[model samples]
Target: MSQMLALAILILVLFIGEAVSIRTKAWIPSIFVSGVLFLLGFWTFFPPEIVTLAGIPPAVAVMLIYLLITNMGTLLSLQELKEQWKTILIAISGILGIVAALFGIGTLLFDFQTVVVAIPPLVGGLVSALIMSEGAAAAGLPTLAVFAIVIYVVQGFAGYPLTSIMLKKEGKNLLEKFRNNELTAKQLPGEQSGTTEKTVREPRMFAKMPEKYNTDFFKFFRLALVGYLAYLTSVLLTPVVGISPFVLCLLFGVIARSIGFLERHPLQKANGFGFAIMGLLLFIFDGLKNATPSMMVEIMYPLIGCIVIGVAGMYIFSLIVGKLLKVSKEMAFAVSLTALYGFPADYIITVEVINSLTKDEQEREVLTSHMLPPMLVAGFITVTIVSVILAGIFVGFL
Candidate 1:
């Protein structure tokens, strides 16, 4: 009975935190709401005795995973991603490369403690969020709770400043492009081409293009379908293939786009925002499952080290990748920043930076469009893989 109330309290606080996010529009993102709740749980601020629970239930992760993957599939198919592939690729390359390198470094530096003494999660994907949470608790790694706290703290805090600064460079031109409805459309020169014909048939309504996109049920349903399918596949493969389903879902998203299973903006801005909220809640609750006073005190050093490496490394890697890819110098930087921090961070940062640079409508929107794909994709995959592992392991499964 008490546990049920504790869970309810978490929901209320997290919801309120999201409200704070909507109102402020500041660097402090909504994930912070969940992060703070997690901290409170670890600290025993509420009923206090709820802290006695050693790990999260398997059900928590399953629900979060399902929702997140659904969001990922829907988001991956959005118009924003279709338009800005290069920027995303370049930045992701840098992000993945750097994290991989760091993971190796962590393995060496931390003596390969498996859960605590290693770096598998650092560069693998955002699924590390779950792994960090669940793995730490279940493995009984030292300072497991602290590591979870730091991971989200870095994620939430880095999002704002980094994204704003990066996007600021794209400026007015990007905004004007959107305002003028100039999203650069190309059609088949001849009506005979199937590609051109399909695009024409689906000419989207500009009226609903504003941020609140997925109000319609069909769009939501499609996203949910794909996401759940990915989850199902992930589960099936877990026993047979012994691999994470998130990787498959991500591949599914990429393939879905490539094969033209979906080619529209499925993730309205509101939907993406909601998706982020759900992911973070799973991230926090599952992460706290194993956090006890004794464990948090053990491996504080590596926990601190990981956060420092993650936040700073992601930021620098994005810039380098952007330049190598030869995207608009401005666009690359903005996009790279988004890749580093994830969605809202990238959006907030891009808006601020763009507002500073140019009032040109076309360029501003272009820059914004460029930044969105990388951040959203990166956010979805990274959060999916890491958070899942974190939660699953802590639940004593996976």
Candidate 2:
């Protein structure tokens, strides 16, 4: 295919997947849909180099990962992070549950190598999957590499409905509380509850600079600098400390944001986040090029085993942690499942459940206020922070 045609085909597939996801209210994830299409396309007529032809080379994807991870740091403020400590503890415990189950039972059903390759993606999302995929490929284990991608592609099917059910139950319970006047819409600390007034805090590092002077190019430049520094620190410390560059990028991104060295949502501010993410997704799909129907079938035993065990682990651990923390089991379990599909899905499912349970704006606000923070925090802690760190460490085992 021509370069333009190849790029168009790739983008078209992503567009269709996104459309389907939105239409389904994220019952079906965009990644799952796009991943299936890519697999089918590669198994049939698509060129193995279609991703490259689409102009998203491996190097470009790697660069985007660094920048995007750094941008993720700007997603939450230090106070926001501190306020979600309970969510963080619960989420991390749930991941540990997955690890325990996988190591304890998964190793028995599958080989140790198989369990090692499976755990990262099971505990996190695309980045963890990418880390495992790349690690498996480097270790000359093509099947394991494909296994990582397959795990990431399908794990959401298990997570979405389960999380939706839990959230719905939690929402209804909250609605009951709202009706009884036991619950009320309340603003988070330092945040205004209603939309009547907006809080606009100036960036500390650039407080004196006018908004117009903080151009897109400047944001990109700052983001790139942070990414570079992260890479450099990883190079110096990884061998000695066993940290991944991706993890460093995330840490440095958070620190940079906290210190006001970078703006909030730097990539989005630069208007480059979407394309950067698309490039990373394309790079992930590139692994599908080598997968065949037979290979997929061969890996099914371990595939099914890992997911079942992993999620079971998440449930048990989440419940334990929730009880100790005095959090409701349903909400805690829902938070734990963020490991399966993070971010937009976690956010989407919460909103969908809240919308389904109540039409009253005040009630909706109360439910959202109660549920959304924990879910978002759980996702950030598990997928954004812990997963990358785990993947970096786990890949070494593989």
lDDT of 2 at 255: 81
In the range 16-43, model 2's lDDT, one tens digit per residue, is: 8778766765455566678779989998
- Per-candidate clashes come to 41, 0
| Alpha-carbon lDDT, every model | 0.49, 0.81
The collision pairs in model 2 are none
Cα-based lDDT at residue 1, candidate 2: 87
Worst 10-residue stretch by lDDT in candidate 2?
Answer: 189-198
TM-score of 2: 0.79
lDDT (tens digit, per residue) of candidate 1 on 3-34? 66655666676677656655554233455555
RMSD of 2: 4.1
Taking all chains together, each candidate's TM-score versus the true structure is 0.59, 0.79
